[model samples]
Target: MLENEFVTFSQNFLDRSGNHRSNQKKINEYLCKNSAQYLIYWRGKVPVVSDVRDQLCWVGRDHPLVLNYSGMPTFLGLENDIPFFSINISSWLPGNYNEAAAGAFFDSNIYNHPDLPESSFFAELRGFMNRISAREAELAVMTRGINVWQENNLYCSKCGNLTEIINAGWQRNCVNCGAFHFPRTDPVVIMLVTHGNNILLGRSHGWPDKMYSCLAGFMEPGESIEAAVQREVLEETSILVKNVRYLTSQPWPFPSSLMIGCVAEALSKKVLIDPKEIENALWVSREEMLEAFSGNNERIYPARVGSIAHFMIKKWLSGSIE
Candidate 1:
């Protein structure tokens, strides 16, 4: 698949040296030797810039502000021969300001590091993922996902005790009960279903006006991916699907979700919108979707540009789907 067709957070240029994750002595050595570059993450946003229009710049090894980190940086693997690390700062980092009413956590923490260049400011991961290079996007995606996990998993679930960082910040140990817990990643299935020349698209209740995309849902326990696709499509749109096939997946790190993308051939086409699951469901013809993709249609739009739904729809339109 072309790199442009990938959903955000799917590209990784870093060589995740799993070899060092469990080796504390080596990590400490790297940290002490001043050979480590850093990615500063605070409440899920990172500093980014394009340098050129519609591009993203990678966080550098020699940025001056990296000198101020006192917190123990989390291991993010190595790029080239230099070790890369990430530091999680408070929600209000050095130059962050308070906002009156920000909707999500991302909006709550738009920061500007004091030492960064004027052209670079902290941006929410999603806002700039589309414009950045694969390496830049991967850094933000990996670090943001791990830090968000750390934030939510500060306490042990079983013993109701505080957990200590272990395994180089990847796992945590409960002090009171001596239980070990690792990071969490929820799995989701986002699928494209097609019948004849039309694709099944559904919109949630609060989605942008007239915007629709592939029907999706979480996979239940004891269910296979193909079964989940069949069940979710049937439940949401009353559309039966067969011949389900897996495509590429992406890490949607708003709170660490692995979106497994798929395509399924529809067995039945009668539309039955499940108000409980979706607001509206329709069969969008390929020609009509082509118009929407080209921005010729005013009332309806396909999925957002950086989403798996958009990728699948475009691939199908281009006759590239296998």
Candidate 2:
């Protein structure tokens, strides 16, 4: 396990200017006066280097990769005096240019950050999560999730009228019906279920070959964290969990999910995986998990280093989880 490692979005370096979100006049004045930069997320394909390391590379507002916007860009709060903004471009930008990074992750548009000219400076942020600094990763995650919400909730949920960005880029307001909306973060419980020296690991159907990690599920309404942890394990793996406690959390913004990490004790060892929920589920000895972490295990590999699953298991292996 890597030492001194911070979860991707847990860094506190960026000072999100909360006061300026409501003060439109002041924010507008700052935007007009200060030399600000943008975190330009085109569709969700964040910019990164083409190297195997896949370093993060956030393009500036004036970069050739960015085209002129048609209207007010979704303004992300400020970091110091430097203002941050994001904009969504039309699909036409990728239709004319033909290099393929379009749509970033979910679509082919990632290939088209206004057309990344087959160079090392531009690539999609698919594998760059571990390669980049935690600070930048946090910024990218925040920038992407907010914009995706804005896109999905363009119209007010209450009324059909289009909503306008109200609290900076954090929220939207419907002029037609006076309704307000904000970016949402869905809570997910990711727990390391342990019994003696072994930890529970489950793999989803489409994961890479031999990859496994902790059991997790979305937190349903009215469910306490402990109850969700216990219920998720029982439903998916047929393992009852007890002594649930918070360990850590990671912002899993593949759209927007807050992965609340926890540690739980298993009451029943007999494994019966719901094939519909998990492809395979079993208990992995801590020694085997350690081996998997170090690339010595042939049967399975550890979770990606930046993920909450990796952090929790690594902490448990290092005797840090209590």
Candidate 3:
């Protein structure tokens, strides 16, 4: 990949003002500022213009939606000194809400708030992630990741006591035990395992038909990135790899994960299936991968656009995986 190129959610677009996170006075000042922008989220979905899904629907601090929400908004970061925050209004229910659709792998349903503009609808970030700019993607993912963490970790793990948001939503403090907890990000190793002219690809059991990407697994405790890459590949595909090297990284916040991308040279090519680990695994030649990317392959669909897998594969195909 080019030096300046970055995958979705990987760009440094916002100055996360860590210094001001602990300052209650500063945070309150930003919240009261008329120019402060807020991104409203509902059940992990953000509002975007239906006609053109290029930008997030940002509202001022005094917007009815903000005024109606009683919960505190999490401070995201600063963009050119303009404070950005995210508020969750998941309590509000829409007339056309489909619970099943909202919980799907990719929610296709669009929900419009009665108080908001007709063109603005809450949509899954993955649905229009590629359509928005890098800065917007970063903001959306940060908001979603933080909100998900807060919702799931309402109680302290150490003491099982209710926790309260502190440090401008950056940390949580236990009301009873006084233990402080921070947002957690699990590390995962996603590797492009190659044997000569072929690259390794695998698909999970319930992935869309023909949609395959690089082999990946969560990194184990006390394991290094290189060691995790080898162990995961061996366990999942029965393939041994050597010369493991790090590539780029992406912050994948589906539920808070840091995808550590790598390139490895396969030492053995024999195929061995692990049904529980993955539905199927295969080695695709460069020619076939190119054809798949161009939509000419009959049995293969490349990774989703704007994903690190897609970025890594494209880089490899262009002979840029250095």
> After superposing candidate 1, which stretches have Cα over 4 Å from the reference?
1-7, 50-70, 93-110
Could you give me the TM-score of model 1 versus the true structure?
A: 0.89
User: Would you estimate the TM-scores of all the predictions?
Assistant: 0.89, 0.87, 0.97
RMSD of 2: 3.5
lDDT agreement with native, every candidate: 0.77, 0.75, 0.90
Off by over 4 Å in 2: 1-5, 50-55, 59-67, 90-126
Per-residue alpha-carbon lDDT of model 2 for 226-284, expressed as tens digits?
A: 99999999999888878888877878888789998888999989999899999999889
lDDT per residue for candidate 1 within 62-164, as digits (tens), equals 5654556655678888877788788776545453365542444236344556666667667666666677767777877888888888888889999899988
Comparing 2 and 3 on lDDT, the stronger one: 3
How does residue 284 of candidate 1 score in lDDT?
A: 87
RMSD of each: 2.9, 3.5, 1.3
After best superposition, candidate 3 residue 133: deviation in angstroms? 0.7
Model 3, 1-322: lDDT tens digits are: 2452668888887999999999989999999888899999889888997667888888998889889878778999888789999998888998889999877677888899987778898998888999998889989999999999998899999989999999988899999999989999999999999988899999999798999999999998999999999999999999999999988898988889999999999998987979999999999999999999999999899999988999999999999873
Q: Rank the candidates by lDDT, best first.
A: 3, 1, 2
| lDDT, model 2 | 0.75
* Backbone clash numbers for all candidates listed: 0, 14, 0
RMSD of model 1 against the true structure: 2.9
